[model samples]
Target: MLLPDLVRTAARRSPHAPAVRDGAATATYAELDALADRCAHALADLGVRPGDRVVLWTSKSIDTVAVMQAVLRLGAAYVPVAPSNPRPRVQCIADGCAARLVLADDDLAGLRTRPGQTLNDAAATPADCAFILYTSGSTGAPKGVSISHRNALSFVCWAAEETGLDASDRLANHAPFNFDLSVFDLYGAFLAGACVDLVPATLAFAPEALTRFLFEREITVWYSVPSALQLMTADGGLLDGDPPPALRVCVFAGEPFPIADVLRLRAAWPAVRLFNWYGPTETNVCTSYEVTAHDLTRTRPLPIGQACSGDQVWLDPPGADVGEIVVDGPTVMLGYWGQPAQDGPYRTGDFGRIGPDGNLEYVGRRDHMVKVRGHRVEPSEIEAVLATHPAVAAAAVVVVGAGLDSRIHAAVVPAGDARPTMLGLKAHCAAHLPTYMVVDAVRLVAELPRTANGKVDRAAVTALWAEAVVRG
Candidate 1:
């Protein structure tokens, strides 16, 4: 089935059910369907045709969700641009997709055009491009990942079944629409006739407000980057508050969940089913691990688990225990937009190994490996050990200098009121890591720098260290 069909099916099954909620506004399945129809005709009048790309640059709201459904109804691929993104980045994505038209929040006021009399469910095929998600490229230009309807449905269908999502489930849409993590929150809910509560960008960083919002909305299924979860539990005192009885499933992806933080969450909400999902945007959640009591006792990072339904995951150079992760199956993206089509498995550029338990253990990214004193080191190894420290909430290792001058530096974010000392952290690292792998310098900071998508911005972290060196 195509992506739009998910909403259409839900609309038919439960017309009056709440489909999406944003702030004070709520859209029922029937209203959402009707809005999409009207928006589709409006786009058609504006010269948008089947197969054309339309840019949806708006904040998280029911209108944004309606625009997406409208684009899908017309058989056109929608490229979502976060409202927080600068104008230049929006322009870059529009130009890259050769978008036929750009629709912003302002356009919603005028989207009540004449409704299209007929709905063409077959306007787009399973193989047709569904959406283009742009991710940061090393070259400073964003590269768009083109995903087909089949690619998205593979994960959406599996997730709905695996989690037993139903009309009763209230999913939290935490990630911005532009981010791939939001795809599951949006489509997965629609596929299961569930309701989605759109979390506004303004409240995403305000942990206290967000925590209250989650309970107020009666969020049943929560998904976001681990950093957001950490912030909610750490600063918002989520654990100190009364337990949210409605919260049943909690899933985190986008980055590793600090082992200590995960343990804390497990202790605070032992009844909730927690999941650690792992994958890049190119492949939406290829592997996931359900948190168990034993997992909380682990000092090392948790395993990413096996592949989900309709997906195949394997390591490159199959015989080796550790190698780059390679993905094959329906969920694999078509390719980077404007790039040549690739065959066989998509090399994820991430390193991993099959452990004795037959689970996929993430070993950091291949590009993240750096050479210091002629010895190769994976920063995750050092970061993992440092994260085990009671005082360290999060840690990132970056390599600085060149050749003989090259050295590894560690940046740490303290947990609670525990102030970490450079010498103490060094001694802690000495106990676990090789002398060569031990960082040359350590700095404590209030928080780690993060990109728009919530991943650690290594370059920004390096700049912070560089600025500190200059001041010294």
Candidate 2:
């Protein structure tokens, strides 16, 4: 079943149940179902046809969820671009999907530069293209990943079944609509006939606001980036008072979790089940591992866990310590939208290996590894070290300080009152790493900027480096 089926099911099963929450505005299952139908009808009026692509360039809201379901219902493929994305990048995604329509908020709604007509309503689907998701371009140009209705149905059903999600689960919609994580929030919620709490993009990084929202709403399932959890766990004092009444499952992805931070959070919330999910946007959560008490401090690094329900995961160049991860399953996208077909398995640029326990654990991006003073350094290695320190709330490592022989620099977010000195951090790294792998400079910031998808913005960090050099 496509997303529409789930919406219809929720309406039938519990029409009066609260289906979505976005700040003051809330919609019951019946109301959400009606809104989606109205939006679908509106789109049909706009001449949108089956397989037509539409770009949703808006912030996360209950309205955004309705728009997504409306598009899928009409058999139109929705291509999502977060409002935080630069106009040029948004244009690149819209163009890549060959979108026939574009939906935006008041600021962007009037744009007529593209060919597609603006959607005033939602239409009905004929089972054509369901959505197109774009993944980061390590080779320089992003690729549009086309996913069909059948593909989405398979994964959503699997997720609902595996997670034991039901109508009682209140899933937090923290990830932007563009990110695959939203799939778990929207489709999974509808599949389980559960309520979805829509957190605005601006409020997502604010620990206090997020904590209050979760507690007040009694959110049962929390899903977001590890960095966000790190911030909440470190600076927000989120766990100081009574814990969230309903929090049960905490799912993290989009980046690696610090083994040290994981241990701390586990101590803080002994009852909450934490999971480390590993997959690219091209493949929406192909594998996940539940962090058991035994595995958390198993001496070996934590594994990404086993593959999801029906998904198949394997490492390329078998037996290698690290290699590109390959996924084969219904969840895998139908290839880059406009790129030529290359035979064989889908190669995720992410590098990982099968642990001795036969589980996958991510290492770092194949391209994220950089040569510094002729020594290959993985930014994650330095970032992981920084994360373990009591003072560091969050950390991102990037190549900074010009010249072809670029020096590694770190941008760290320090925890309150625990401002560790830059020299101290450098010395800390020196003890654990080689001379060349140490960060040349550590710039302590309040927080690192993040992409719409919640990963640290490395490009923005690099830009800050350039700005620093110019000012100096």
Candidate 3:
């Protein structure tokens, strides 16, 4: 069945049950289904046809989800552009997708279509493209990852089973739709006939606001980036207070969680099942590991766990230092839209290795690997070491240079007034990491730059480092 089929099924199972909730707005399954039909009819009125690309540019809200489902019902592929994105980036994505229609909220007066209307409700074959997600390009131009309806359905089916999601589950829609993590939040919740609480953009970043929304809404399943979780852990009385009564599972991805923070979360919500997930936007969460009772060490790094329910992960044996992660699975995107397909398997550009326990562990990005003088350096290694320090709030390391020789430059947000001096931080790295991985320079910042999806904005950090070097 197609993704929209799941929504229809949910509505059939519980017409009056709450399906989506925004600040002062909530839609039961019947209302959501009827509205999606209206949206589909509205798009058709705007000349959108089957297989047409439609851009749904809106923040995390119930309206965005309705438009998404509506596009599917009309047999058109939905392209979700993060509302937080810059104008140029949004326009670039629309152009790249060759979108036939653009839908935005506050255009209610413009929608002259009636309810109980739809272009189609048939399943898209595996060969039919469902959506195109554009990656945040740090090295160059952004590439569109084309995913089919069957490709995403397979991943969410597995996610639903693995996470024990069901009708009783109330999943929090925390990530922006532009980020692939939202795929799980949307589809996984639908597969289980679960309610999706749309966390507002303003509240998503604020720890107290997020905490209030969670318990107030009785969210049972939570998913977000590790950085956001870190902020919540650092907040006063956030972790120490009573956990959300309905919270059962907490899934984290987009970046590695510091072990200390994981432990802190465990301490705060002892009953919640914690999982560390890993995947690129091209592949929607190919692997995951559930934290166990005994593995609660504040100093250890969490493993990326085994492959997902229907996925296979392999580490390329390039050399001893690192290898690129290669994935072959249904969840893997067909290829970048408008780009030629590679004959071989999808190579994730990420560096990783298979541990003795047969778990996959990420090292860093292949491009993120820097050459210091003559030695190759992994910035993640230095960042990992820096995060071990009590003073570091967040850390990002980037390579900067014009010639063959480059230096390791770092941006750090320190905790409290006891900041680590550049010399002392370098010494700390020299002690833990290899000589090549030592920081050449450290610049303290109030906060690390972030992309629209909340991931570390390496491009912005690189620009700052380059500007500093030129000024010097």
Candidate 4:
């Protein structure tokens, strides 16, 4: 079955059930379904057709969700560009995907012109591409990870089943639409005819507001990055008053959760099932580990645990020792956009090893790709953009700190006597990269350190930036 069928079937089951909620606005399943149909007509009226890609460049809202459903119903894939993205970066993605249309506020509101007439569902199949998620590329551009209808359904079905989602449940959508985490938040809720409460962008980082949204909305299942859980509980006092009776399952992914924070959460909500999910965007959550009370005795971070979601996850290069994590299953992405189809096991650049308990544990990355604030960032992508600056002769970027709290620092060599200012380079990056990928701190250097192989030593670049109490 197609991904859109989830909502269609749910609407059949409970037409008047609340499907989506954003602040004071809410859409019933029947309303959402009709809106999607009108949106499809609006899109088709604008020359969108089957197999074309449409870019949705807007903030996370009920309208954006409707547009996604609309795009899928038309047999086209939707590319979600984060609201935090700059104009240049958004255009880069739009151009990269050769998008047939880019929808905005006016476009979303234009759906009203079509009335409430329901359009027939497009003749789409399970193998059809449902969406293309663009992530940071090591080659200086964004890489589009193409996920098919079957690919997404495989994970979404597993998620709903694993969590025992039901029509009475309320799911909180903390992750933005651009991130893969939203797959569960949006589709899983739709599959079960449950209501999904969307957190406003303005209050996403405000601890108090987020915590209040969780309980006030009566959210039963919550899925987000580890940092968000940290901000909400540690600072927002999520567990201070009393555990909300409605909240039963809390899932965290994207980056490793600090053990101290995890232990604290478990201590407060002993009954809540806290899950540590691990996977890159290429694979929609290939593995999951449920946190148990035994994790309290552990000093280090928790293990990523065994594979789930109908994916085959294992370490490569035989069974000698630690190796790169590889994934092969339905959930693995079809391929990167503009590339050939992926026919074999996809090699995940992350390194991993089996623990004494026979669970897959994360090792350090084999490459420089890292997640900052739950968004995947490639240092080379930022460095490439910085190198384009006329004031800089060379550029290098390194991640500082650990896990989700890390900051990106860049060291650049001046072009002759031309000294690049921090603000200048930051402005340059702001124009080219997303807010999360932009370097947090900038430092000037005469030259970058290189090893005997003549490759720039990223570690030394990191050390030079660490030596700076002063910004460039």
The alpha-carbon RMSD values of the candidates against the true structure, listed in the order shown, are 1.3, 4.4, 2.2, 11.5
Winning model by lDDT? 1
For 1-472, candidate 1 gives per-residue lDDT tens digits of 8988888999999999999998899999998988888888888779888898998888888888988898888899999988878888899999998999988888876886665455664367898998999888878999999999998998888888888798999999999988999998999999989999999898887789989988889999999999888888878878887778899999999888878888888878888989888888888889989987877667667788999858889998988978999998888889998988657678999999887778898888888988999888899878988998999999999999878899899899998899989888889989998898888898888889988777888889999889998998
**lDDT (0-100) at residue 159 of candidate 4?**
82
Q: How far is candidate 4 from the true structure (C-alpha RMSD, Å)?
A: 11.5
| Residue 426 C-alpha lDDT in model 2 | 90
Q: Please give the range of 10 consecutive residues that has the lowest summed lDDT in model 2.
A: 109-118
Give the residue spans of candidate 4 off by over 4 A: 369-472
- lDDT, candidate 2, 72-167, per-residue tens: 777777888888778898888888877777778752322212233323333444234588888777577777777766667667777777678999
User: Model 4 scores what on Cα lDDT?
Assistant: 0.83
> Per-residue CA lDDT of candidate 3, range 354-385, in tens?
66666777888887776777787888878888
Candidate 4 lDDT over residue span 1-472, tens digit each: 8988988998888999999999899999998898888888888999989999999988888888988999999999999987677888889999988999987766678775687786788899888899999887888898899999999999998888988899999999887787788899999999899999998777766789989888888889998876567557646888787887889999988765656667778888888988888888899899999998988787544789988889999888879577889999989998999899888788889878888888888764668778887887777657757866778656778988878779999988776589899889989999988888778888787666753222467778877766664454
User: What TM-score does each of the candidates earn?
Assistant: 0.97, 0.89, 0.93, 0.80
Q: Model 1 misses residue 148 by how many Å?
A: 0.7
Cα error, residue 471 of model 1, in Å, equals 1.6
Which ranges of candidate 1 are over 4 A from the true structure?
A: 113-118
Worst 10 residues of 3 by lDDT: 108-117
Instruction: Write down the lDDT of every candidate, Cα atoms only.
Output: 0.87, 0.78, 0.81, 0.83
* Winner by TM-score between candidate 3 and candidate 1: 1
